[model samples]
Target chain A: MLDLPTRHLHGPGPSPVPPSVLEALGQPCIGHMDPAFMRVMNEVREMLQQVFGTENEMTLACSGTGSAGAEMLMDNLVEPGDACLIGVNGVFGGRLTDKARRAGGVVTNLHADWGQSFSRTLIKEKVAELKPKIVCFVHAETSTGTLQPFEGLADAVHEHGGLLVMDCVTSLAGRPVELDAWGVDAAYSGTQKCLSCPPGLSPVSLSERAMEKVRSRKTKPNSWYLDLNLVGNYWSGSRAYHHTAPVNMNFALHEALRLVLEEGLEVRYARHRRVHERLKAGLETRGFRYASDPEWTLPMLNLVSIPDRVDDEAAVRKRLLLDHHLEIGGGLGALAGKCWRIGLMGHGATDEAVDRILAGLDAVL
Target chain B: MLDLPTRHLHGPGPSPVPPSVLEALGQPCIGHMDPAFMRVMNEVREMLQQVFGTENEMTLACSGTGSAGAEMLMDNLVEPGDACLIGVNGVFGGRLTDKARRAGGVVTNLHADWGQSFSRTLIKEKVAELKPKIVCFVHAETSTGTLQPFEGLADAVHEHGGLLVMDCVTSLAGRPVELDAWGVDAAYSGTQKCLSCPPGLSPVSLSERAMEKVRSRKTKPNSWYLDLNLVGNYWSGSRAYHHTAPVNMNFALHEALRLVLEEGLEVRYARHRRVHERLKAGLETRGFRYASDPEWTLPMLNLVSIPDRVDDEAAVRKRLLLDHHLEIGGGLGALAGKCWRIGLMGHGATDEAVDRILAGLDAVL
Candidate 1:
């Protein structure tokens, strides 16, 4: 039997889930097709729509982690020979490109520097040239802790006759995610990030036009388990049965959404911003710098450049874990070892958690 | 708020978890990389190995549902232009074929009737002809409750110089899965089925040969999250922390595996078989016939033909929930509404549960 250690999760996602959500997770398992469980599923779907700010009827949680949702959406939306315009500014953006290519879509990438937002000018030019069926970008890139503003990108895509898909994995609960208001045709988010829930399910919603494409697909969905057309039938539309869902995780997510709604979306966004502001002040006081531009940083995830003298990032991380029971993330891909990503998501973004991380870094530095 | 109706789950999966496992789920969330939590992860990995009957160093739980594991293995193992062979006996087998093809593999499938086992001779011939990179099959088809015996299929695969991957999602805990002894190169299982854990993580293991292929891949895996080379870092050597694991779900699984091991693997296997036998007797007494062959049926999941008079499978299912508060699974894909899948699995396979289901069914019938 494994016992959970007492530690403050200051790393990205798998944040400190509220005790209420944990209690919800322990509730007894139910059949996915059970009327009562389906009822909960319906409420979860509605709540997810509220959070995502979408009226898309095809909204439901994919039975996997965040990236699986990405793959599921891509698998159905993009097919062989279809051109896809991908905005690659971080690891997750790179993933969308990879998934599209694997699905036989011809991927055209609009590259951006890691920890940087997409340039609308460059995207508009690419859209004009490639004219892809779907224009995909990450709203909040978890790897680089950068938020890409797409306030007008969707309109650009629509003008070019392409639908917009966004990755809201890190932004869904922490900030305002107006899927419909922002004209996002398709989007996916993880439960573990700002939701203050354990990582497992990925909530996805698709616009009516996107739903039509899925319904009238040129080919059968390759992955039957995640074939959203059929999955949606189970989730909605008469509550048809599919595979067994992660019942307890759904329970946890439902409770997490309840908390998010209870706090109100605005309050949740404010909480994230407040903690990030305090943490930023403390880090600046400690002479640390950030990787992402101040204007584009995610409130819940802060990726900062490590000081030159911090030769061994792993050692520093180990020290933090041993001395302060604080867990932080090291940079990935090209940024590996150069930056530390400190997260203040959901229950983790508190004054005490922020102070402890700063103090731990101070001791190590 | 959607209230969960109190129900007895005898469905194919999302099987009713033990109260202990349920209690474990509600425990406070911990950081995935927390040292104590890593120890818990280590226990889960080791116990998974014990259950899998493998010494594969790469054994770890992927933080997704069973289908995600299937997608992960397919993405990592198969690439563009790679040839693969699959035996299609039920929905799962067909889904695996779809997954393989979606990952850009040129798939050749040998079809078997639903609720029927494969002929090793035919598969061996196909193996000789196709010479595929991967030969895949389902050990236990949950939809039809048919157990396909490997027999000499593995040796044939190795003889043809192909790696054999088995979907043990419905077989692992309920049956004797001797992975190393049987020469299976890679395999995946779900926590929700025979393990009696909630569905969030998929336990997967790979042989040394499979790991070598993963290490030597020419292209980056299509799905970044499911990529074994990267994910293995989080689960094994690199411990690089690829993604935030579903912390509490892992705790629930660790405890579930402990319960599995504490009872002794053979004892647990026998317990599942014993409960299945009792349930089968009860179902037989009620004049219900199993869809699968008697010799090839999986004990954990029983696929029974619903009576023709029961025109409304959905209504019966609804009535079961509303009137009796018991849950069972309807058929999927080709088997939809034609049959019902009843599960007798870990903790949920008690004799009392069997009696309750029988009584409930009698009242409904």
Candidate 2:
């Protein structure tokens, strides 16, 4: 067997998986419907609801990556010419709009500058004009490390008789996501991000309103695997087998959820916040400026402006990988080469890991 | 963390993973581009090529389950109104046709009875009439445990100026695929089946001509993550990041591939065949009949006719699960409750497992 390298993952998602989670993942494989595994699966659902802070019955992990969740939500919520409003401030928001359009939805964008949160007034104006069936936005934009203020946006969407679908891919475990309290009809996140599991599955939840819309959808979902109705039934207590659950990955996710619960959601969130503050302070002392303002910054993934003299962002990333065994992310899309993404997520948010990254950066600089 | 129950997995695809592969899967998480992990990834690519018996450059594993590979192949190969021909004899074949149609392909089926293989003459005749851009078939029909002949079909597809896409999901490591020798252009298989890896990734390989067609596609693939051109770059030497790979799962696959290579391919195939013979003999003693003709039966997955007196297949399956700690598959689609699918695959294809299953069946009967 080819051997694995020991390296601390400091990238956007898939932070260092704890040993307990790894042991859970390596457990004996079980049938998707085995009573024992099903018990764990059901527990995972309840635990995820606790993390998402919602009581959505349709909540469960999709068998693919985070993007698959985005596509699944779009496929179920929108059909041909169904008006949808998307927040487009960073790479993930652009993806949401693209997926919405691909699903035959008429998409209108509430544009914001990269690393800048959308103004509540602008969001209100867009909602009033488009009055779309769904108002989609990212709670924490990983690409620019900006967290959009969703309280006003959610209220605006609801007032206009629209549902709010939020992308909490980077924020769910690191920060509070009040799905019920904030009126989010649908939300999706990755296990690898703040959840600190490997990156193969996406945890998604839908509110009662969202489930009702799916129940009353005009078309059969375009994709079979992502069809939430069938998937929901399979994941529910009925335990009807649909597709083969990624058994090992699910085991890892179950452990991840267990870890989050044991640590206490509030404690874990505070841990992430503490690590973010330490890392940010260290980076600033070393002459770095964050792309997002302090108020809207994501605690897990930090976006920093690249110095002009850097010249080759890829080379610097390569150096970090080779010399320090540190894997930081590069800016994506329009922000490429101009910003770097340093993540402090899940297990990687520990103080030692933060110090290691800072020490590596000091040596490199 | 929920402890995994020790159970024997003799189901359709997510067969029991070997202990070595499981151990490898639990190894610490690493960056996808870590030099050590990259070496493993490269080795995995090489091993897949060896098992596939082709030097195709685009051989790599998709992050989702096997069905994702099936969907991705169709999404990349077919466009709106493109004429495509599919063989429909069992559940998986029907699914292939359904997915193709959903992807906007004008699908024509070469019909065959369930639990039976089609004649080469009939298939060639049907393909000539259809004049399709792509001709799809399943090497092993999991639902019916039928092994269809593909050598003649591949030649016929080439003669008609069409590429052949084959689902080797159940056949790859269990039987000889011979991609180049058989003239098949594209093939996809699940890791859980014959490789003894947990079900999370599907290894797919595309011939040069098939990839060229994908590269020159008229429209963007509906699913962004499944797009071959984009996903290939992630696996290619350039190492452009696309998505966070399920790192631990990839480790499991690498070790599984090593096990396959260490136990020679021919020996592994012989072992599967031997265990299948033992099971067939035991089942015959219990008054069971083969669902398909012996000549066309797949050794990896066997379909047995349900007895007339024994009704409620669900009860029997449930009893098996509860009493024996064993899991076998039931027939899907039209054959539900009519047949039982007994899989001898990966780690499940052992003499001990077969003996235990037979002992349990004696009580059920």
Identify the candidate with maximal DockQ. Answer: 2
- The candidate that wins on TM-score is 2
- Alpha carbon lDDT at A236, candidate 1: 82
Query: Where is the poorest 10-residue window by lDDT in model 2 chain A?
Result: A1-10
lDDT scores in order = 0.85, 0.87
DockQ for model 2? 0.70
TM-score, every prediction: 0.92, 0.97
DockQ of every candidate structure: 0.55, 0.70
Query: Candidate 2: where is the Cα deviation over 4 Å?
Result: A308-312, B309-311
TM-score of chain B of each: 0.97, 0.97
Q: Per-residue lDDT tens digits of candidate 2, residues B57-91?
A: 89998888888889889888887788998999988
Candidate 1 wrongly placed segments (more than 4 Å): A219-222, A308-311, A362-365, B79-85, B104-109, B119-133, B213-222, B307-314, B333-338
List model 1 lDDT by residue over A1-365, tens digit each: 45555667787767888888888899888776666677788889999999998888888988877877898888889877888999988888888888888667889888888999977788888888888998999999888999988787777788876889999999998998998898989999898889988888899999998888888888866566678877888888866665668888889899999889988999889989999999999989878899997789999999999998887889999888777777888787888889988889987878988888878888877
lDDT of 2 by residue, A1-365 (tens): 55555777887766888998889899989888787878877888999999999888888998888988888899888877889999999989888888888778899888889999988898889898888998999989989999997785677788777899999999988999989888899999998888989888999999888888888878776676787877888998467777788998898999999999999999999999999999999888988999886789999999999987787888888888888888898888888889999989998899998899998887786
CA lDDT, candidate 1, residue A320? 88
In angstroms, give how far residue B259 of model 2 lies from its true place: 0.9
